[model samples]
Target chain A: MSAVVITVTSGKGGVGKTTATANISTALAAMGKKVVAIDADIGLRNLDVVMGLENRIVYNLVDVVEGTCRLRQAMIKDKYLPELYLIPAAQSRDKTALTPGDMIELTNQMREDFDYILIDSPAGIEQGFKNAIAPADRVLIVTTPEVSAVRDADRIIGLIEAEGKYSSDLVVNRVRVDLVRRGDMLSTEDVVDVLAISLIGVVPDDESIIISTNQGRPAVLQNGSLAGQAFRDIAARLTGQTVPFMELDGHDSFMKRLSKLFKL
Target chain B: MPNDRIKIKGTSNGLVITLGAGAWPRLVEELDALLGERASFFKGGRVALRVGARLLSTADIEAVGQVLSKHHVTLWAVESEAEETRTAAAELGLEVELEPRPISPEQSRPTAGDTILIRRTLRSGQVVEFPGNVVVIGDVNPGAEIRAGGNVVVWGRLRGAVHAGMNEELGEMAVVCALDMSPSHLRIGDYLALSPADDSRTQIVPEMAFVHDRQIVAEPWSV
Candidate 1:
């Protein structure tokens, strides 16, 4: 079956691009779909560590692109899900090592074998980012609720549109609803107002998410993680399932819940 | 020396860089250096090239195109006197010639009373600069910038930096207005005004900004 190549990108670093890629791919795989994740950040390879496939990477994306190894040789099977795989980036090489054509060629070979190919793009709008987006059938822009992240997401949306890729869904990650309720942080609406894009997911800031990430078990596989549920909802939407946006606050005051309910 | 070899003129289509007779490689190097100096101005711009009587192969035109692309400029058409140069440019799918705007004594410069209408959003890091007035029909996000020699107007939200009456002696006469007047900063001629650090206004109103008493002041638009 042909796979839909979805490039997950964030213009600003530290905005959960790699984390989202790992979790979303894992969630999709757990749903009985074949999935693969490619880390396009060559020099700063972290997706392997995030995916807990660091030790399993003998051949990388550069090796596959340079024909030093077979494409199947570079695919590292996921630890938690048999249906998921990851093509790690080459830690020693820079973004210049892989061209846009190489990325397109690599994804094209994987398309026949997988249901979804999620490319974790580098932080900047450089060669790495371009390579990741060149073959994308869809784009998912990840951003935090902060103004800088939202602004960068807007910039990424513009660049994607310029590339003739018309559709991009926004993923607001690491949002602190407490701060948002206190009127201290930007709300999801504020971000969507500035970005003017479709909101696919809003992953709340959770301490357990960091813990699960450190253990190489993405929170999506965890039992009681709010961020995990948010990513699961994202995956559910991706698979053509209608999942409503979950309430981030489990302990919101009754007044707040009532107001939210009324608004909905 | 570079100015003598290379000349930049803005036509109705876009900027045109006219190259004097020289060795191909040296001319290309000179053009690259000139563009690198004003890289920001040329970025996201599409320009034509006028190679006077100089024969170019497809590779030569492509080499120049590579240089322009390095600076985020696009080479769309090539104006050449030599038939060989025109044929090479055409072979590479470049327009051999643009519909020339005849120059007149009164219209020696195309900037006079000229205004460009931009119909799309200017996202972060996108910039629009013109020697005449500028009007944008969409929002200008925070890292975007607009520079105009005359008046500036945005029909939607404007939250970017804008410089009106840019490099013009009649800078104070240039006015800037938008439906929402939130901007990073405003510059009219030499005057500068910084937006407040906190955006407390929940309501958005169409406001016009102009220089008053040697300072830029924005007021709610009237009429």
Candidate 2:
């Protein structure tokens, strides 16, 4: 099966690029699709830690590229999904150790083995960033609803366009729906207006996400979580499903509850 | 200096690098030597090579650009008689001109301030800033900005921030028009108007904004 290589990037750090990669990869694999997750953040390898596969990494992406080990030897299979695997980045090596050509060749070799390949890109708009995006058939930009995050997302979108990849979509993470209703936080509409790109997902601010991430299990595997549901919806949309966005506060009103019951 | 070659003059607009007809790599080496001779002088200068009759391809143009950029010079335009060279320059976002614009006394005089027509929709985060009249044929999405020195016109929806008649020299008069006008913020001269929260109601019709009684006011398109 051929893989669709998608790079998850945020121009600024801490906007949840790695988290989105883990969750989306988990969600897609749960749907019975073979998925491979690659951590492109060379020196700062956190995707492995987040996925709870840190100890399983004997060889890494650098080893595969350097011919020190076979490609399959570096892949650490996921604990939950048999079809899911992760190729962790090398913690000791620097970003300069690999070139954009190396990444393209690596992902090209992986396309035959998986249905989806998610590359967790490092922060910034430098060589590391270019290396991550070089092999991407699609891009998923993650940003918080804050002004700084949205502005950086705009710059990143412009850079992606400059690279002649126009199919990049956005994912708004950590949106507090309560603050949006109170006019305190930026709404999905506000962000979509600023970035001017197609929205793929809107994940609410869920405390469970933080807890589950610390436990090395992404929240997307937990059923009924709002953030998990958003990730699942994103996966469905990626698969060309037309799933409508869920109302996070559907239990707040009786009328909303009635509408939810009948699925009207 | 031993191998005689064509003369080139670098100007403010672009580089006028000259090349002599000879062996390909030798001519290219001569070109590089000329550029390295005045590296500081060509810094930040866009290059428009003047190749007299050289058949050059896309790869040739791109290689020169890479070499020039390493020396902090930008290849902006090219002047060539070869059809292949001109086509290659255009593909690389460079302008190919047969003759440069003459800067005679009359030609040096500033032309009348002209309007720039923007045909595409200005999406969010896109800023259109110009010193002359600006016309947009498409929607100005919210968070986008348009700062103009003269009148601004939008044939489509204008929901972004706009400042018309900016710059003190432009005087205290400006006009803005849109088919559906509900801008997040609108400024005419020095006055500002914050759009209402329910912009949906105010955006469904044609409107114009101008300074009336020293206040920024929105009026019906016909009025």
Candidate 3:
């Protein structure tokens, strides 16, 4: 099957790109689709840790590109998901180890085997970001509800549009429903209005994410986590499923409404 | 093309170099050699350029700047009859026109009657700079900027920072108008005015900003 490459990038760092990549790829794999996630950040490699595949990465993206190892040797199988694999980044190398051509070549080799190839792109609009988007059929720009994040997202969208190749979809992460209800934080609509891109996911700010991240387990594996469900919904949407958008602030529980009304 | 179309003249300000009609690369090479011939005399000197109808890109203008800077020369002002060259110069933060000095009066015509028109939404990090009048047919998003030597007009919402009369000579004559004007700030030549907090952005009002009594002011645009 031909794999659809989706590069997840945010212009600014620390906006949950790695976390989203880990969770979304896990969710997509758990859906029984053969998926492989590539960690494009060479020096600051963490997608391996987030995906719980760090120890299994005997061969990495750099090794595959540098001819030190075969492409299949670098593909690390996930712990429980038999259909999922990860091409981890080299911890010892910088982003220059792999060029855009190398990334395109790697994805081309894997396209015949996997149904979806999720590229966990490094932050910034530098060489790493370019290499990540080089083979992308579509791009997912992750941003938080903050103005700085949104502004950076706009610049990324502008850059992608300047390339005029891949279609960009926005995934707004870490949305605080409480702050939005209190009018202190930006809402999804506000972010979408400013960004003017199609929304794929709206993950609420959940503390379980931090616990899950440290445990080397994505929240998508959790049953009751709202953020986990959001990732699943994003995966379903990616497969052309008409999954309803998450009701982060809406469909609030009775207790949630009471707290919001009391705050108002 | 012929010999060298480069004419360098000394004015009250450092220098006024007029670039006549020729291929852009050839003109740039000629300018580099001409400045290199007397590097010591041009050291720490500011010069204004007059390129008549030579449509140049932002990179092209910066190439010229780099060629001049190689010889310790500062290319400050760029007076071009072409709208593209002027916009490129203005985008580079160089003065589109000199400070009301006797610039090249013999270069076909001035940029007074010229205007640049952009028909796209200027997103963040995108800029629109023009020597004369500028008319944008789309929204100017936040973090985007427009620096105009003359009047500025936006057909859509203007939510970015915009400066009119950047050349300072037309400070009083320049007026910036927009439909739904809620810019981050407004500037007219040397004067700056932080946009008044426009809370009621829902109600659209076409307004014009101009310098009056040494202060920048915005009023409803009736004309």
Candidate 4:
């Protein structure tokens, strides 16, 4: 089956692009799809660690691109899911070691074997980011609710549109419901209004995500985690499933709930 | 010196680099050397190359563009007297003439009639500048900017910075109007004003801004 290459990027750093890539790849694989995750952040490679495939990486994306190893040899199979694989980045090399042409060729060769190829793009609008999106069929931009993050996301959306490749979807991460309720943080509607893109997912700020990430197990594997559910829903939406967004305000005051009920 | 063959001057739109009369190879080499010498000053700057009466081919224009781009400068327009050069520049998506055409001696008097129309949203980091009035049919998000020599009008939301009557010689007669006026910064000639801090949550309504008593003021659009 042909694979749909999707690139996950954010102009600002520490916006959970790597986490989204790892969890979304896991969630898609759990759905019985053959998924291949590529870490396009060469010098700061962390997708392999997040995916729990760090120690198993014998070869990397640079190796495959440089012809030192075959594409199959560089792919590290997931310990839990038999259908999931990850092509880790070369920690010793930088972005210049791989070009956009190399990424396009690599994804094309693997298109016949996988159902979805998810690329975790590095932060910034540099060569690494270009390489990640070179072969993308769709783009997912992750950003926090902060003004700086939203502004960067807006710039990234403009850049992606200028490329004329694929339409991008937005995933607002690290959203604290209490802060939003207090009017101290930007809501999903505010971010969407500024970026003017379709909202694909809204991941709440959950402590379980940090714990699960440290354990080398993505939060999506945890059934009770809210962020995990968001990722799962995002994957479903990616597969053309229309899953309604989950209500993040679980601790809404009675007056607020009454107001909402009365308005309806 | 060979560097004297290339002259760079700052204009209202951007830098205008004039290539002196010489062979194409010599002119190109001198231009590259001049850019390399002042790379830091020219970094992230837009430029228009003026090649007087030269019949430059597409490849020649492209070569000049490549050199400028390497120095972190954008070649947005090409001003040339030759038809062939203008056609080559247009083929490469560069403007054939500099923007905000210079007023002739007979038409030196400033008028607020000429305007440029834009039909799309101006996202963050986008800038629209014109010599005459500007009318936008879409939203201007935060961080986007619009600078005009005369009045400015937005049929949609205008939440970005806008400078109307950029040419101070035209006096403070320019006005700015928008369906939802909440600009980060508003300017009329030399006067500048910021949106009130508490106006963010206010309901959207049609408004007009202009210079009143040497200060920028905004009022509900009536006429």
Instruction: List the candidates ranked by DockQ, beginning with the highest.
Output: 1, 4, 3, 2
Per-residue alpha-carbon lDDT of model 1 for B1-223, expressed as tens digits? 4576589999788899888643456568879999999999999999999876554767889999999999999998888765446655765777777775464323433363677677667788766666778889889889889988889999998999999998566678999999999999889998899999998987788999998888889899878
What's the TM-score of candidate 1 when only chain A is evaluated?
Answer: 0.94
lDDT for each residue of candidate 4 in B39-135, tens digit (9 for 90 to 100)? 8999999999888865576788899889888999999888976544665576576777787656442353223556667766676776766667889
Better of 2 and 4 by lDDT: 4
- lDDT for model 1 comes to 0.85
Cα RMSD for candidates in order:
10.5, 10.2, 11.6, 11.0
Encode model 1's per-residue lDDT on A139-178: one tens digit a residue: 9999999988888888888777645466699999999988
| CAPRI quality of model 2 | incorrect
> Residue A183, candidate 2: how far off, in angstroms?
1.4
What value of lDDT does candidate 3 attain over all alpha carbons?
0.83
List model 2 lDDT by residue over B52-143, tens digit each: 65546567778777878888887767677644355456556576763555543243222225465766556555576666677898778766
- lDDT of each residue in B45-159, candidate 3, tens digit only: 9899988755567888899999988888898889876555666776677777766645443442336556878765667886666667889987888888998888899998888
What TM-score does each of the candidates earn? 0.75, 0.65, 0.73, 0.74
What is the Cα-based lDDT of residue B214 in candidate 2?
Answer: 86
The DockQ-based CAPRI class assigned to model 3 is incorrect
- Flag regions of model 1 displaced more than 4 Å: A249-264, B1-112, B167-170, B200-202
Clashing pairs in 4: none
Model 2 ranges with Cα > 4 A deviation: A251-264, B1-222
| lDDT against the true structure, each candidate | 0.85, 0.79, 0.83, 0.84
